[model samples]
Target: MALDQLDGELEDQEESSEELYEQHSFKIDGGQEPLRIDKFLVARIEYATRNKVQKAIDAGRVLVNGKTTQSNYKIKPADEIIVYSHYEKRGERIEPQPLPLQIEYEDADLLIINKPAGLVVHPGSGNPDGTLVNGVAWYLQQQNPEISEETLPRFGLVHRIDKNTSGLMVMAKTDQAVTSLAKQFFNHTVYRRYIALVWGDPAEDEGTIIAHIGRHKRFRKLYDAYPEGEYGKDAITHYTVLERFGYVALIECRLETGRTHQIRVHMQHIGHPLFNDDFYGGDRIVKGTVYTKYKQFIENCFAICPRHALHAKSLGFLHPTSGQQMRFDSELPADMDQLIEKWRRYVKAKGDLIVESK
Candidate 1:
């Protein structure tokens, strides 16, 4: 089907007889005067962007005093306002192709899954199918027939994982759970830990990376720790080495402040970028005899693993309803295990001594 037709179908599925909008009337108080209807609506609704608000007004989706209004129409204090915003259809049709998922724990309120490397967490842009969100939606539908297209989680996504990374992720099942989890994430109260394989060993065994991260002005797709920009946000990540395998090191990172590509960018900032990350541009010994020896192995691994070597290994947070501490873990996926084992064997065969860590 065409993209526009598919979008229309999804939108129709999102509509419901149940009204989602709430009517409100604000009286002019003190010296306050009338404000633009679109501006007023923007202030009252969360997640409604300025452009979306404007579009809604232009499309006759907003009414002032029970009458349709223009985008620039002003609103008085006693004017009744009504908005017909059918909850945005945010769900995508991601076919569940029997993709391997390592489920750790599950309950009515939430689910924890050990996501494998190369799987897109949510669908967007180039990837619209075979996402974790699609799998979850399929699973939920299987478990409960009441989980209709309209009630599906368009906003229940409380947290996210990078496309190439593998590890544990917590998903909210209810809107209440979503709100509670979102608050916990915003407050930096949720405990998130990741295990990554980087290119070089760190000088220090453990240390904190405090840096301001923002978009690279030159490279929009990649992030950088810029000194100035409205974009940068404070990010803190603490990392410790679990074991060093000569050229590579397995490290555990704990996030104090979560930002886009926090662990990846911070690791790159410290001069130790992740292995096999083509975007960041790091050095790997894939040349001459070494390249020939591992070419087939690398090809096989890449065919199975399409993402970076990061994983959300552990997550801890407060349960929404019970208010009890909850934590979940996901073990390393099979492909990564195979890669590590192959590298280890190759190193040992080349007479490179392996260090035993107790």
Candidate 2:
């Protein structure tokens, strides 16, 4: 699957994130006859037409034995199959699961949440349960037993951040709210500011990154910033260096267009990727010293903030019904705070030798 598929839609989010992909896995019976993959899938999968199956195969959503398969490929006995789709599938529903959530604000129209890193926003094939959606469903249902998971609008989510990127998020509680909030995000009127600890000091105090972003051609899990604009969707991110530590820097990113991995990819395009961001090549010492002590310090910093050092520090949007602009801000999670502090002390102590390795 393309990273764009996993990135989740950035706009017009009235469509639930779960609806972006439908997944089904099957193991062929031992006595099954050899048949074209598409026909085989169509016959076994409910509500799936031959046309739809063939289209999925053509789009590389159908996999046989863990590899993308063409429609003409004959499925032999004991073949393993998996299919993904942008449409709905039968019997798919979010099973409410109780989870610890930090809700900053809540009301009839919408709610603001400070999502922690490591928590997925919604459920997918890899994560069938234990998602924000599951917890929210349980929370909402606790108040109103009549609410149905299948019928809830967008599962009440207006927008989403990446799983490992901690930050604030807004969710609508009603269909009317869904339409209003989704339009705000789609129109690019929503305000969102993120804090990122990236490798290297940016030459400029502030700059804008304008590029086209899409999934990497080779690595589907990572995105690529296309400076030439030959592929992908247009994206823009404005960033300001909040502090400098010689080897690395603390930066604030204001997103103009929220493409998937927008800040991470754009920063890398400009030679600065977020610290400890394994996906975009920030896990290693991109900058700083190769000396044993410096390496140890960086390794300790990694242990302090293990995930990508990005946080959605603030979010703003107009109230769905009242037109009152609602904005929320969050403190950096403990890990990032400690990581930054360690860098602050390190830079102060060894200012002259900080960039020795770079």
Candidate 3:
């Protein structure tokens, strides 16, 4: 996706930190007739038109068999077509609200925030206002009353984390910062590490999860990990076991690519859904004994952290103007911290019981 024009008007659309341009891939059927590449794509892609497809082709964002192609090029049987589209956003401005925000780091070009759980990043659907973006707008307005929405890129938000996932996030204060930071995120150069409490103990202490993640076929709101790359975008997560209880574990996950719900979906794919993650089937007791006491203990832990046990623990990237490395780290929020401590105590007491019984 091109970053040539950062000052252009943008819409109030929802996008992840890692998704700068929407990508679509198609494999031509064996019996399909030859058709112009632009026309071929327009028919298949939703809300796409000949002009948009041709513009994408002219920008060399369309690839056939991994190579750039002309808009009029005839599609062939069994040919692979990939298209990258960077759509400009335009709509009503986000209402600046005086919401409380935890500023971790700030400079002339960017701002780092320790986002708390239960705070929505961007307004959408049920969330019309009172989001992180709205807070940032208010903050920016406080800093410069005359600042216009067009001057700030994504309203200073370069990336986002889930509302339930607390931790560090960076926002670009200037257009140049947005351009540079967006490139870093798209290139996968930015560093992101998450702390997660998963339901089961992984076989390996450390490993990498390579899968294509996309929206679930049946559950449009939820994402699924496709190991065969059958659908969705490429996603990778490197994980290391931090602590182990018999039934669950604390793990650190480093993202190589940021797809929507990448860590949550990938962990679930490997058979270890995040503890208490209602969307991915972790809301119930996935591990441990089925005894009443054990079940009650697990329920207590769930009550400690009502949401999914995931936190964006750290973030790193290059400064937009200085070309210097800038990294930030955050502590686990109270809920997650308390949950881990409870697990620790539970494991230790169980160990003591075993020792005494023997």
Candidate 4:
């Protein structure tokens, strides 16, 4: 809810290149007694001091039952609450250095990269150096020796994946590329797909999740699905199961509308969470047996991945300069690829433990 602290500890990149993001929702119990929303929230929300709640209210980011409410408004039972802030802040200055990059495709107007897991896309407060941005800037400097991070109008990233999520990213290299590609993202014409290993299989082999995602009221960094489209922007995700391991499922997600953490939130809303996604309560085992050996195996899996099992496996969009359609695919990073293999072996050894795959 608070931008200062969110689902993850990432600093804001350049302000002009950044967009405000929301990821945190709450619902009051029917029998709850009246209490000042801010006071009530402070007591209920973890790490949410009274001062922070008051400020969110003052900023008009606090909502009650789908309407903006002040800090002092007495909350009623069944009243849904939500808070929001810019996903990150422009907290620090950015400079360039010769950081490494895994280039996939590059042209005069844009660059496609196979970003590794744990790589921050840009310079932010917690990650002030050695980011993909820094690396790209350095690469650009080698060619022109005149362009620098400060001189660049924007970071050139049309969109971003999370720091822990691995996959393909296409960043713009020129002003024309920025405007054209950004428009594609805004128009929801950019085709994006993600691969994830989640805790459980879905009820359907394929389905769409359409919900208004907003910030979690209690957990400031997490999100909740508002089915009524109340608190946040509309988001749509379609998913199809590719494989199932009794306790987990490997699925593909197609984004029709891109929002922060869209796939993660939708999967969670459907009772499945991405494996090892610590922010959304996926670090612990959500499925599987209670046996010590199974528990140890899960813990081992966590150790292997250490981060959420998600990857931006594919992207397709029109070329900004040529207006020609472009598409790219990437192999899963080592951690996720190996994690799936581990599950595959476990399922095979367990025989009947196998869940039917779609």
Best by lDDT: 3
Alpha-carbon deviation at 353 in model 1, angstroms: 5.2
Model 4 over residues 1-358: C-alpha lDDT tens digits?
A: 4432344334222111112334347888899888998888787655667876776666455678767788789988888887653333333445667877889999998899998989988766567788887788778768777664333333565577888889998877764565567657766888888999999767788899999876665665566788898776678899998988878999999998876677888898889999999888789989977799999999999999999999999999999879999999999999999999999999888884655554
TM-score, candidate 1, is: 0.68
Pairs that collide, model 2: none
Q: Local distance difference test, per candidate?
A: 0.65, 0.78, 0.80, 0.76
TM-score of each: 0.68, 0.75, 0.78, 0.74
Model 2 regions more than 4 Å off: 1-91, 352-358
Q: Given candidate 2, what's the lDDT at residue 114? A: 92
Regions of model 4 farther than 4 Å from truth = 1-92, 149-151, 353-358
TM-score of 4: 0.74
lDDT of 3 by residue, 249-324 (tens): 8899999998888989999999999999999999998987689999999889989999999999999999999999
Worst 10 residues of 3 by lDDT: 3-12
lDDT digits (tens) for residues 1-358 of candidate 1: 1101123322132211111222234444455477887777677766566776675565455667767688788776567776544333344444544455667888888888877667777666677777887777767767775664334334245567777778877877765565456557755888988887777767778899888776666776777764343457777889998876676677889998777777888888887887666667443433223566456655554554445667788899999899999988767777667666766776687787666433
Q: Residue 228 error for model 3, in Å?
A: 0.7
Best model number under TM-score: 3
How many clashing pairs in candidate 4? 9
